[model samples]
Target: MYKVIFRIKGNQGNSFKELRQAGFIPIYFRKNGKDEYYVTLFRGKDLGEVKEAILDLSYYLSKNGKYGDFNFATIYEVGNSNLGKIAGGTLGALIGYYAGGIAGLILGTLGGIFLGELADIEMGEKLVGVLGWPMSISR
Candidate 1:
């Protein structure tokens, strides 16, 4: 179970259109330079495959700057925590409803869900650790 999101700059063409049409989930951002694409690794996709595909696309973009490299900013997140919202909510709701009924149930469920999503975050240590991919905020 893996998921990722990324942005790649490339030229506009039927290739991109075809990808989107085929459910690749590419969002085209119109630009003056090359083309920018904001894409998410759609659900149920393999992280390995996505990384390989992105690398291949990067090569293609470098070759054809017209259709690529508009703005070289790749934003991606890989991995997930299965101990997320559903678990949190269920546990919270059960406890709340037994203790405080409707009011407790509502508050507990909301808090649980919020905390669950936060707790669900996981980083790609393989990519950054082994592959040496730089993840930095300083511009």
Candidate 2:
């Protein structure tokens, strides 16, 4: 997966969280004279796939910015990480365990309200990750 950073401008109508839930990450910050945001999109590592994604992003970015009547920043490559077999299992276990714990809490306060709350938080964090919320201190 590739992690990218970009920005949205002049969207009094759309919020970051909303955009994120709609399948875009918003890692934005105020720097110099402009506001920028980030987005991470999952794609195949092949060059053909990368090029297609780029073209799609260019169109989407342009359209999204136009919705607000302002030009948005282009994406910058921040970093990349490999998701091997271990990563898949780890991620599944993490999400499932927390989800089960949360359900247990909501059903009967499994371990305690504290644990429930912790589980809720963990679930939220995982949801953010699954939803591709940009990782940044600004948010």
Identify the leading candidate in terms of TM-score.
Answer: 1
**Residue 59 in candidate 2, Cα distance off native in Å:** 1.4
Per-residue CA lDDT of candidate 2, range 32-64, in tens? 333445444433454344334544444544455
- Residue by residue across 1-139, what tens digits does model 1's lDDT show? 3333334444445345434433445433444454444533334355565545545444444444423332343434545665678988998898889989999999889888877765664333123211212222111
Give the C-alpha lDDT of model 2: 0.39
Question: Worst ten-residue run, lDDT, model 2?
Answer: 128-137
lDDT per model, in order? 0.49, 0.39
Residue 28 lDDT in candidate 2: 39
Q: Against the correct fold, how does model 1 do in TM-score?
A: 0.35
TM-score for each model: 0.35, 0.33
